[model samples]
Target chain A: MSPPNALDSARAFVVDDEEAVRESIALLLRSVGIASRCFADARTFMADYHPDDPGCLVLDVRMPRMSGLELQDELNRRGWTLPLIFITGHGDVSMAVEAMQAGAFDFLQKPFKDDDLIRRVQKALEHDRAQRQQRRGLTELQHRYDSLTPREREIAERLVAGESNKVVAIDLGLSERTIELHRAHVMEKMVARGLAQLVQMILQLRGSSRGDR
Target chain B: MSIPPLAPDENPLPAPPAESARTNFASEDRLSALLDAAVDPIVLIDSAGRILRFSRAAERLFGYGSDEVLGRNVKLLMPQAYAQDHDQYIHRYQQTGTPRIIGIGREVTAQRKDGSTFPIDLSVGEFRSGAEQGFVGILRDISERKRQEQELLRSTAELRLIFDNAPTAMSITDIRGHILDANHACQVLLGYQRDDLLQRRYTDLTVDEDRAALVADFLSLNAVDDSFSREVRFRTPDGGVLYALLYAGVVCDIEQRSLLMIVGLIDRSALFAATREADELRDRLVHAGRLGMLGEMVSGIAHEVNQPLTAIANYANAGRRLLQNGLTDAAELVSILDKIGSQADRAGQVIRSLRSLTRKREQLRERLDCNALIEDVSRLMELDLRANGLRLQLKLSPALPPVHGDAVQIQQVVLNLIRNAAEAMQERRGDEFVRVTSSARARAVVEICVSDSGPGLSAEVEDRLFEPFLTTKAEGMGLGLSICKSIVSAHGGELLYRRGERGGAEFVLRLPTATE
Candidate 1:
C-alpha cells in the first residue's frame, strides 16, 4: 500500500481505554484511507504526543484516571491547538453541555455508526488546520506592527478601532496631513495592500490574541 | 440310700444331699476286697481314730503302702491343720454317741505321702468287729470334680462379660415380658438404672405404638428357634424417643421349659436423622443451583452473544462494502454469507443454553459422556473465559466411561466451577490458565479438576469455603461452591478443593460410573 499523501497526513489520534473500540474506530478510518493512531489511555497518548504534529484528537469522555475534559485542559495548558471530538458511553445532557462548553468539537455516543465518527474526525482535522493558518498569519501581523514608531503605532491602533483618519487626527490634536502620512507609513510596515485587507488583518490578530488569552 | 456297715439292731437311714452311700461291707476281709475294688479311695478307721486298713486305691491315692498307714491314727492322712479338730470330734462322738463321725459326710483336706494336701469327702460308719466298737470311715478324693466346676464358672463369667460390653444393647426378659437381666449397654440405651428396668416390663420402655410389636416379638420367641428382630421406638429417660433395633429369642432350660427371652437393641436415631436431612438438603440445593446458574448466565449473556454479534456485523458490513464498491466475487459472497449465517447460529446456540439453564426439571438420571458434558459447558463459557483474559486447557481422558447423573445438574456443576476459576483470575492478565481435566480415577470414578493460575483463596475463606453466602468476592453471593458440592454428592460423588501447586485454587469433582 502507498503511504498517505501530505494533504491526508493530518491524522486522527484516538484514545480510549477499550481496546475493541480503539481498534474498530481505527479500522473504520483505515477503510476510507484516513491515517489514524490509537492509544489505550490519555497518559500514553500524552507521552507519545508531538506538539507540532498536525492532527485531531478523538477521546473517550469517561476515562478512569484522566478524563477527556481534563485532557483538553492539559492540551490547552501546553498551548497545543488540536481540536477534539469526544466519545461518551453515557451521553447525558449535562455531560454534553459541559463538553461542548469546554470547546469539544463534537461528541458521539457508543455503538455509533462508522460514518458519524469519520465525519467528526475529518471536520476536527479541518478546523485544526484552519486554526494553525490563522495563528501563523496573526504572528506575522504582530511582528510587522511591532516595527512601527510610537506615534505611528498609536495611529494604527485608532485605525484598527474603526476611527477614520480625520477623526483620529482630531482626537490626537494632530494635523490631518500628518495623520494621512502616518497612516500611509502604517499600511506600508504591516504590508496591507488595501484598506479592507488592513482591516481584516487587524481583526484576525485580535481574534487570535483573544484565543491565546 | 443308707450309710454303709450298719450295726446289728439299727434301722436304715437316708443319706443327705451328698447321698448315694455304698453298702454290703459285713466282713472285714470281704469289705477289704470290696474297698480295694472301689473307684473312690477308702480308708478304714476304728473308734479311737486309728487306721485299720488302707485299701489298694487309698494306697495309690496317698502314695503309701497299707502296712505304713495301718494301726496309725487316721489323722495321719488328714492335713495337719485338721488333725486336732478331727481327734476332738472323734472323742465327742464316742462320749455323746451322737455319731458325728459315723453315718455322716464331711469334706476335709487329705495329706498325701509327699505332704501335699488335697480335698476329699469322708463318711464314717459304726461297725462291730467281734464286739469291739469301731468306726469305718470312707474317704473320697474330690479334686477332679471341684476343678471341673471351677472351669464351668470361668466360662460363664466370660460370656457375661461379652454380653455386658457389647454394642448391641441386650436384655433378658421373663415370659411375661418383665426384664430379668439387662447388660450395661442396654441400661445406657434405655437411659435407666438396672433396678428401674427390673421394676418395669420390657414393653414399658417402648413407645405405645411399638409396645404391641415388642410384646409380639417377645411372646413369639418360645415358638421360634432363631431370633426375630425389628425396629422400635423406645423411650429415653428424658422423655425423648429413640429408634432401636430389637432382636428377641427364647432361652430355654434343659427340660425344654422357657426360661427367659433375650432382647437386643441398637440406637439408630442419629444415623437415620442425618441421612434424611442430607436427602432434603440435596433437593433444596438443586433448586438453588438453578437460580444461581441463571444469574451467571444472564450476567455473561451480553459478552457471550456480543462476540458472535460483532463477527456477524463485521462480515455483513464487509460484504455490503464489497457490493457497494461493485467488486463482489461469487466465492467471496458465499463465504461471507456462510460466516454471517453461522455466527447468527452461534448466538442462537447461546440462547438455547440459557433455556437449558432455566428449565427447572426433575433429576433425570442419564448415562452421559463426561468429556462431552464438559465440552458443552466450556463452549457456553467461551466468551467469558476470553473476556476475563483466561485460557482454558481441557485434558479429558479419551477412555472415560459414562456416568449416571442429571445432565443439567452436572452441567450446572461444571459451569459453576469454570466460572469461578475464570473469576479467580479477573485481576490478573496474560499467561493465566483455567485448566479442566477429566480422568477415570480408581474405583470406577471419573474426576474433573479445575485449576487456575490466579492467587488462591485466603486462609479464612479456605476454612469456610463451601458455607453458603460466605464469599471472598465483592459481588459474590458465595453459594456457587456450596451448590456444586451438593450437586456432586447428590450424584453419589464428592466435591473437594485445595490450594493449587501454582498458588491458585484447584477444585476436584468425582462422580461414580453408571452402575448399569
Candidate 2:
C-alpha cells in the first residue's frame, strides 16, 4: 500500500481517544512498512509533537476533553504547519467542511478501506515533505540573499520588478555599468541560474516575509 | 240528701245585717257556672272516695256523662293498680287525720270510661258542713306532656349511636378550641384513648405549622351552618405525622346561636405519598421518552458504535495485508486477531448501553460515581458536539464520593444539560465550547456543573428556567430542564441555574452522597 516514492524516515502519528482505533491504524501503517506512533488523546500527542517531524497526523475528529480540531487550532496558533488527516466516525458533513476550511490536508470517514487510508496518508506525507523542502529552500535562499552587498540587494529588488539596468542606474544616480555589476552579483549570490529563477526566489522570499506560507 | 255548701270554711263569715239571703243564693249560682268553663278536666270526690261532682271538662275527658258518676267511687277513674291501694289509703287517712293526698298534689294513673289508662294530677282537701265531714279531690289530665318527653329521649340516643359508629374521625369542640366530645374513630385516628383525647384541645393535636390556620378557622366560625375544610397535618402521640382532610362545621340551637364545632377528619397520608411516587415515575418515563426522541443522541450512539467497528475493520484489513505480504510472524498475527475480537466486543458494549438507556425500565437506585457518569455522557456527546461545531472540556475530580440514584436517569440528566449547552452555543460564531466539571462539595454532596461559552440566559428566562412548557427553541417541548430538575429532586438532590463565569448559563446538579 506504500506509495512508489515514499520517504524512508517519514512516519504516521495516530491520535484517538479510543485505544482500539488508535492501535489498529498504527498496525495498518506498520503492515505497509511505515513506522507509526500512537497517542490515546490529543493532549499527549500535543506534548510530544513537533512540526519539524516528517510525517502526517491521523486524528480522530471527536475526542473527550479536547477534540482533534481544537488541537489543530492550537497548532495553527503556534504557526506550525503539520499536515492533518481527520477521521470521523459520524462522517458529519459540516465537520468535514469545517476541518477542510481550517487547512486540513484530508478528511476520511471511519470504516474506510485500508487502501484508501494508506493512499491519503502517503499523499499527506508527500505534501508534508514537499512543504518542508520548500521551507528549507527558502531558508537557503534567505542566507544567500543575506550574503549580498547593500548595493547588490537594491539592484536585485529592482531587477525582480522588471527594471532594466539602464533605468535602475538612472534612478539611483549611478552608472549603468555599476548597476550591471551589482545585478550579476545578486544573481550569483541568490544561486539563480537564470533571470527567471532569480525573480522567482525574490518573489518567494517576499511572500514568506508577508506571512503567506 | 242535703246539698253540701260549696265553701270550705267551717263557719261562714257573719253576713252583714243589711245583706239579704237572696244575694247569697245568686252568688252561689255564678260560682257553679264558673266551674264548667275550666280548660283542665276537674273532678270532686267525697271522704268515702265516692265522686261528688264531675264538671263539664271532666265529663269529656273521662268519656262519661256527669249523671252516671255522681255517687260512684273515685276508684272507677283509676287503673286497677292504683285503685286497690287507694281505698285503704283513704280509710287510714280518715281515721288518723294524717293527709296523704289531702293537701299535696301528685301524679297517678287514672282509668277512663272505656277502661284505658292515662296520667293525671290529683289533690284532695277535707270540708265539713255541720259535722257531716267530706273530702273533695280535684283532678287534671297530663297525657300530652308525658308523650313529648319520651320522644325527646329516643332521638338523642339515636344521634349518639350514629356519631360513635361513624368511620370518619369526628369531634365536637367549643368555639374556644376545647374538645367537648370525641367519637370512637377520632380516638383511634389521633392515637389517643377516649378519656385522654377528651382532655386535649383541637389545637393540641394539630401540627405546629398548621396551628395558626386551625385557630383562625375556628375563631371565624360565628354564624349558624358556618363551615370550613382543609388538608392539615397532625402529630400523633407516638411522634408520627399524619396527613388528613379536616371538615368542620358549627352546630347551632333553634335560636340560631352557635353551640359547638363538629370536626371530621379523613386520613390522606397514604394518598399523598402515593401521588408523590406516581409523579416521580411519570417524570422518569418522560425523560426516557425525551432521550428516545433526541436526534443528537441517536447520532451520537451511531458514532460510538462505528468507532469500534472501524477499529475492527482496520485490524482485519491490516492482517490481510500482512498475510498478502508473506509475513511469517505468528505472534503478531495472533495479537491482531485478538484485537479484532475485542474491538467487536467494544462495539457490542456500546450498543448494549444504548439499549439500556432508551428502554423504559423500572428505575433502580444504586451507588454511582459522578465522574463515571459524566464520562459516559461525554463519550456519547463528543460526536454531537463536533457535529455542532462545538468543543467539550471535562475536568472531573478524581476522588468524588459516589451518589445514590437511578443510573440511567442521572445519566439522562447529564446528557440533557450537555445538549442544552450545545444548543445555547449554536448561534455563536467562534471558539464555541461546552465545559463540564464534577467535584465533591461540602455537606456530603457531589456537584456536577455544565457551562457553555455562549450567550447567557436573559433575565426573563433565568426566572422561570425550570418551569415546564417554557421554551426558547422553535421545536422544543421545553420539558427538558423541568424534567431534569424533578429527577434530581426525587433523588434528594438539587438542580440550580446561574450565570457562568464565562458570561454563559451554568447548571449545577448536586446529589447527596451515597453514604449520607
Tens-digit lDDT track of model 2 for B1-516 = 001211233332332221232133335566457668877666655555556567788889889897788667677777776667665676565556566555776777777899988877766567654443455656677788777767777778888888988888999887675777899988889888888877578777889999999888888888668999988899999999989999888887547565778888999988999998788767755654665454455456667777888889999988988787865388889999999998889878875665454444436779998888788778667877998889999999998989998887788889889988999887877999999999999999999999999898999999999995588885464657876787788888999999999799899999999975
lDDT of 1: 0.75
Model 2 misplaced stretches (Cα beyond 4 Å):
A1-7, A90-98, B1-209, B216-305, B326-331, B345-516
Clashes of 1: 0
Clashing pairs in 2: B47-B135, B77-B111
**Model 2 per-residue lDDT at A90:** 54
Compose the digit string of candidate 1's lDDT tens values, residues A49-129.
988788899888878799888899898788787888887652244675788888888987654666677678778877887
Each candidate's B-chain TM-score, in sequence, is 0.55, 0.49
The per-prediction i-RMS, to one decimal, reads: 5.5, 3.3
Taking chain A by itself, what TM-score does each prediction score? 0.77, 0.88
lDDT of 1 by residue, B1-516 (tens): 112221212321221111111222356567667888988777765555556667888899999997787767677776777776665665555555566435668776778999998877778677764434456667778899878888989888999899888877888877677888899999998899888898478788778998887778766665536578898898888998888777777677547776767777878888779978788767646654564555565545645565455446546665665566555688977977886788789879986765554344436789989999888777666766877677888999999999998887888888788888888887886698899999999899999988999889899888999985577775454657776776777788999888999899999999999988
